[model samples]
Target: MTHQEPPRGRRIPGIALRHRWISSVMVAVAQLIGTNGAARNQSGRVHLDALAYVLLLAGPALLPLRHRLPVLVAAGTTTVAAVYLALGYPYGPVFLSVIVAFFTAIGAGHRRAVLIIAGTVYTVEQLLVGHWLYRWLPPAGDGPTSWMTTSGIAAWLLAVLAGAELFRSRSERVARERRERAEAESRRAGEERLRIARELHDVLAHSISVINVQAGVALALMDEHPEQARTALTTIKAASKEALGEVRQVLSTLRAPGDAPRSPAPGLDRLPELAEQAAGAGLKVDLSTVGARFPLPPGADLAAFRIIQEALTNIVRHSASRTARVRLGYGPEGVELSVDDDGPSSPRAEPAVSGGNGLVGMRERAAALGGTVEAGPRPDGGFRVLAKLPTGAAGTVAVATEEEGR
Candidate 1:
């Protein structure tokens, strides 16, 4: 069997000592009553006098084990008291031990057993002892109950209440600490995930943007200048290397503690690179605008950058055609980004199907910035992604266009 340690507050040596001292006082009082200021028992039994004192002193030693063995302590006290009574000793200290035992039982969370044992002890003690006192004296005339009787009942009630309060306070403290730890862990996890997402966005946006630009140049030279086409390919290689370096920097930052500052995070300002990279990747990303450019929210720039990055990535991964279009329009209110591809010439072309995390990530990103994203295949044989972020201003004008200026 496994033994669980009690809580720290409950484990203090002082608390056990406190219980022991209280038990010792009770036992001493009982011994004093039994001895009645004399060295011999009522029957002049000197051995009984010595025995009672020894047993009373021993009672305190059992206090340390009160919580661990409440029932046993109660039973032992009852047995010893029975012996003391049979030997014609006074009932004072034995009464106190019984009261203390009742409390120990309650403190141990064995209230049901305490009730049963208390009832049985009260019945046996009263029957064997109470009747004798009653027989010797008629009903009391104007006397507050005996000191032992009144105090024992009051002490038992107070101990049970005190024990319950101690248990409640301990429970609340533990629950509060557990909740704090859980919240701290959750916050840490959220920060780590955000950091990773930012790094991946940076790597992907930089690489794809370079590829789009090179592909555009290559297409421009395809028929008239084969050598120029090769040059554009070389440019693509350089861009890819630069992207790899940036990605490595990001990964390094994630793994190690460093003071090296990172380049500016990707945002709306990097749209040109994104469009150029998509063009290099064989997608003609046409970007145009309407309305005056105004300062966007802190997250707007990054949101714009991500929408375009994912759109271009989708183009590269899904479309078979050599042409795609991208548009970004700044309205009086918010900005809108839309990317569309012409219907693929081959029906066998597979569309990009994110295992779901990508879309969820995108949606989460957009929603966090008070924006929305919609993506689906166009009936006319293409795919489109549109994102709208409300600038929370009235000046924003949204626009949408595709094939036939649709």
Candidate 2:
């Protein structure tokens, strides 16, 4: 939902100065000509003169200030209109100014004031002027106004009030809808930012960890064993190439929103590649699965792959043990993955295992799909990471993409 911005002004722009001034002048002209025309036909009523013209113009002249001072303008217009009626002048378009003022006041959120002013005017016109003072008033021999006329005037006032209230309510509703839409857009932007951050962290952290380890090996062996150093170089090339590809895929979403990914996200199908990379880093990864394999949603598939990848990367960089174990279990409800290294954890790995973006990113990925990740030191040795992710139906998970701002 959307709303047009109201014109900016010192006061409520619903009754802008230009519009009020123009309307007031137009009303004054209309009342002058209309009252004269009506007076010609109703010969018994008091004829239009200088005093009557002043009163007719006076009510409309105050309309320009209604927004800034709603209660004062409403009361002033009502009082002037009541006085015009009491003096026995022929009634014509003089009521127009009163209508404009009352409507403006109510629309400006001064309904109570307008109501009180209108009610008082109605009472005075019906009781004092129409009934009691009609005899002494200018129209000689004029009798008290009939109850039917008073009832009609009362009904007219009520109708004006009702119409003004409706317009005010509709304006408020439009403003509210605009606010909700803005908040939704802001929330979407925030989610998109977090998704990009999380994806970048997972992608770079794992591949860089592999690259860092291989580079160290290549440097250590370059002089003593060129062949082994060359093999390490090859592993480094492969790891860097894979990392660049994944980074490109994740960033591609920013360029094209709501479009299918250039390549499918890696799933358990890439476990062999992960194991091979671990081997090059001198950490053997053992992969095993339980339960029948079934198709998983894209969000859950991507999350599981990243989790296992991060776990293996941590084992290669932080664990003293040479072997790491990865287990995947599929059930009717969800998918569970576990990565563990058996040995004492390296001193440098303590802070990472205890508190780092790797574990945080893994948990974020899993939680986005209503899953969970738990990582801690093993009882007798190294560290372990376990994640449980739900395999939801297609389109069920509303994962935020890198192109969220779009």
Candidate 3:
């Protein structure tokens, strides 16, 4: 149906014009051989002459252009075949070439056109050739064709169109399936890229915020407070080192899939390290645990850790408050995390950078795990981020690990 390229299994299993040429020549030769053989029995019919040969071969001659112009070729071939039959030449393999043209036309999505032409051509043959003009033609004394013979020919025409229509439906279905598969693969690829991007942003945003604060401290105290300046430089070195190590951990999974991670992903158990890091950046973070503690599923563990990490990083970058609070609660089906910072947003720090994913990233991480995140300014003059992550799914960790490898 598509004009962009020659279709497969239309006329034949090929797209090149040369294949059409070969097929046309083969059909012409077969028709010539079979018609000559049929002439031995049908001596009452018109004799084969030069014009008879030309008209007999005309249908196959037009076969080469069927893919590009099927409707015209189908109509032309059916007309030529009808004329050959009307001349009262013994009917044998003379219909072969036109049959090939009919299939080609139908396959190229011109079934309606081909069916109309074929029906019209058959009507003319039955009227003038088989009934009305047989006496005037060279096949003298020939009367109208028998009712049985007319019915059989009509059935044959129906069979050809029906067979072509069936094949067309099958090819259309296969094409549709292939398109769906391609679209699915494209969608999966996009999701994988976004997941990896979120991982990188979560890993870098916190450490970078720490490094920035420490860098400012070291610059201001270089001369007057050399001892404090040294402490600030030490914190910078530690933060950069940890950032690089975690970045390598993420990249290693990419280079070698299905292998053990160089180190396990950080979980909420590492909250003390976060507190120490916040303290180094001059923010006193208080951590609390509620309900009972249990090892969370890997998906929930990673999501909970990142949500809290991002919340703390946001406080360090956006909130003027010197103290932040974090509460982790474990329920039977899921874990809840709440991070809070007191006071209005910082003029010295910065807003969640112009186009950055801060709270949005937290929400995405939670939603991926069949959970939700809610963040807003509290009525008590502070900002709070709350997330709930379900841990009931099996193999959540393996799926996340495999995606990073890709």
Candidate 4:
């Protein structure tokens, strides 16, 4: 029963008033014709009007208030019809206005009130009018019976009531469906926002960590090893540029017009660049692949790349080891990525590897795609991170590896 506000600047009240005016005018014209007694009676004889034309027009004039005061309007129109009939007006259909009022009342959600008011009005008016008609009209053998007239009027009223109720029910159903659709859309929008936030967090955290390490390296070697300091600076430049590109790509996806060209998401294909950047940041990286690589779904591909990137970034930042090995294994069911660093476990590294936002993000990504990720310190050596991701079917496979020579 909640009503929706009409759209702004549309003048809904004026439009409704205009429509009511048009309806009243049509009904008034019909009543005026009936009042003239030009229309024939059921018995083919003209029944001249004894009621004033103004009284006949009054029924339709009351119709404009039906929506606002349903019970009162319906009763008023019915009373006017009865008065016209009692005064011996030609009965060609002065009750048309009464039908409109009854329908309007029911359509405006005043069903019980309209029924009670209409029923009372009909009973009182019918009793008084029937008695008057019985005395004033011709013999029953020559004219229509009072029972037939009353039955016809009852049938018309019932039909109008039923039609209005049906229309109201349908409008309510359509409004309910529209509200449901809006709620569902809002839920989807919220989920998308969370996803975008996670993506931005993962991308920025890893890149910034790399840049921080390289910046430290550049500052440390500035006097002792200027050549190496320049190399660290170069690594910083490349990492920042790549980070900027990835950030732009992520932001472009959120743009409404989508006019900007989008860069492809990084995957296993970018491991060489990733390893080289890590090596420049003071960690030697050896990346290798086993078995044949197959095409992965976009979500699985992005998840795999981010997991690997996060693992490598963690090793470069926390591990004391100078060398790390990354093995990429492709199986019939899925792809496996493992990063093992030859760095001894430190108390600082334990907290980060064991319980950190990086690991949690990796686990979330894997679980979202029905995959799993494992990260812990190796028994005799450094930290190791392993992830397995599913790819539904096998396709054209390729293998590529980059191993740094000692």
- Candidate topping TM-score: 3
- Per residue, candidate 3 scores C-alpha lDDT tens digits across 1-406 of 8668545435534547788899999999998889999998988888899888998789899989888899998888888888888888877888887788888888879988998998898888876577777778767777888878889999998998888888788878888888888789898767767776788898899999999999999999999999999999999999999999999988886788579888999998888998999899989999898865667877788889999999999899989899999998766566788999996788997745554687778888898889999988898789999998887633355345545778
TM-score of each: 0.58, 0.79, 0.80, 0.68
Query: Candidate 1: which stretches are off by over 4 Å?
Result: 1-156, 176-180, 187-191, 194-233, 245-261, 321-323, 329-334, 345-351, 354-356, 390-406
Clash count for each candidate, listed in order shown: 17, 1, 0, 0
**Higher-lDDT candidate of 1 and 3:** 3
How many residue-pair clashes does candidate 4 contain? 0
Candidate 4 segments exceeding 4 Å error: 1-111, 114-149, 257-261, 283-291, 314-390, 393-406
Give the Cα-based TM-score of candidate 4 against the true structure.
0.68
- In candidate 2, position 82 carries an lDDT of 87
Query: By descending TM-score, how would the candidates be arranged?
Result: 3, 2, 4, 1
- What is the model-wide C-alpha lDDT for candidate 3? 0.85
Clashes of 2: 1
Q: What is the lDDT of residue 324 in candidate 1?
A: 69
Between 2 and 3, whose lDDT is larger? 3
Model 2 poorest 10 in a row by lDDT: 394-403
By TM-score, the better pick of 2 and 4 is 2
Please tell me which model should have the higher lDDT, number 1 or number 2. 2
